[model samples]
Target chain A: DAGVTQSPTHLIKTRGQHVTLRCSPISGHKSVSWYQQVLGQGPQFIFQYYEKEERGRGNFPDRFSARQFPNYSSELNVNALLLGDSALYLCASSFYRGEGQPQHFGDGTRLSIL
Target chain B: AQSVTQPDIHITVSEGASLELRCNYSYGATPYLFWYVQSPGQGLQLLLKYFSGDTLVQGIKGFEAEFKRSQSSFNLRKPSVHWSDAAEYFCAVEDSGTYKYIFGTGTRLKVLA
Candidate 1:
């Protein structure tokens, strides 16, 4: 089966602008999570949704939000983009929100803020 | 809060030589440990994971990790280094209650020919 897929592999936005990144999890997966990776750093968790409900959240700012559809696909939304927000956004999926289920990742969407 | 630490920011190893990357995690409970590799301009690929059972767990790409509860370490190791292994490696931990992963800064491997 195809791994998790993310849309708009690359994106450019200006300050004060908003952007939305999409992700489709693997077939039969019911959990999706979002992460942001800056240069020279590991990915930081943003949000996690399971069964269309929010399950976990990281230390990201309020400007960042996410939602999951009934189909288990997800969208990460960021408002008032700043130059600091220019980073690669990653999406991961697992069979469920439980232990022993390693998440599978997508290539990620590179977001550039100007 | 749970966290992961990779002391070596970058490591250089000769091709065909053994390789080891250090990872230490801080968690009160038995956390799920994982190792992931990422090539330039790519997402992370799972190298291996350890949940329970034998402390030594094998993963894809000839990678293996040993979970040491006493040391709070889950260092990744490979029998022989390959040029293709010249990528960034990240160590992460997830608490059982919280499924979110806490990742280390990462270690960039440079394999010399």
Candidate 2:
């Protein structure tokens, strides 16, 4: 029973460059969500995908986008990254997008934008 | 608009001492509340959650939280803290019927042995 797993544990990119972070949800999970955690702050929701469909989005800009694959994996892509984009990107998954279902999170990807 | 506030930015306590972390939320209806712990360079882990029924909820790692409707507060508590318990704690709330969650700024706990 593996928990959520994310790739490219760390990444560095310059302004105007784009980066993609991937996540594989726990087996048999069907919902994947993305969050961004800045230094000294709690994570902020970015997007959520259920059954390969976009279910919700946060107050993020259009430059932040995500999609869930058929296998319930997900990718979060940030375009034209700015210095402020430097943060820890987290991926969480739940058996279902239901009330009271707590999300399980991955170790997260540390993104540094210069 | 739902939101959560963790008034304390950081806290320091000696190991084996009692600990309490405050959390308050703003929402129209009764909200689904949760407490999550995040260690350095790690993702958030659920400590406990409150939906309804009992106001007090026990969680993993010997953590517990009490929900007070009148105060709009869901504070986490532990009888005795351990060094390994040092981490960032976040309080989150979701609408009664929605899956969307709003998290607090988080409180960083520093345990001194």
TM-score of chain A, every prediction, order shown? 0.98, 0.98
Candidate 2 local lDDT, B21-106, one digit each (tens): 99999988878899999998898998998989999999999999999999999999999999999999999997554586788999
Q: Model 1, residue B73: what's the lDDT? A: 96
Task: Give all candidates' CA lDDT scores.
Answer: 0.95, 0.92
How much is A36 displaced in model 2, in angstroms? 0.6
* Lowest-sum lDDT 10-residue window in model 2 chain A: A96-105
| Candidate 1: regions farther than 4 A off | none
- Deviation in angstroms for A1 in model 2? 0.7
lDDT of 2 by residue, A7-73 (tens): 9999989999999999999999999989899999888989989999999998899999999988899
Q: How much lDDT does candidate 1 score?
A: 0.95
* Interface RMSD per candidate: 0.8, 1.3
TM-score of 2: 0.97
For every model shown, the clashing-pair count is 0, 0
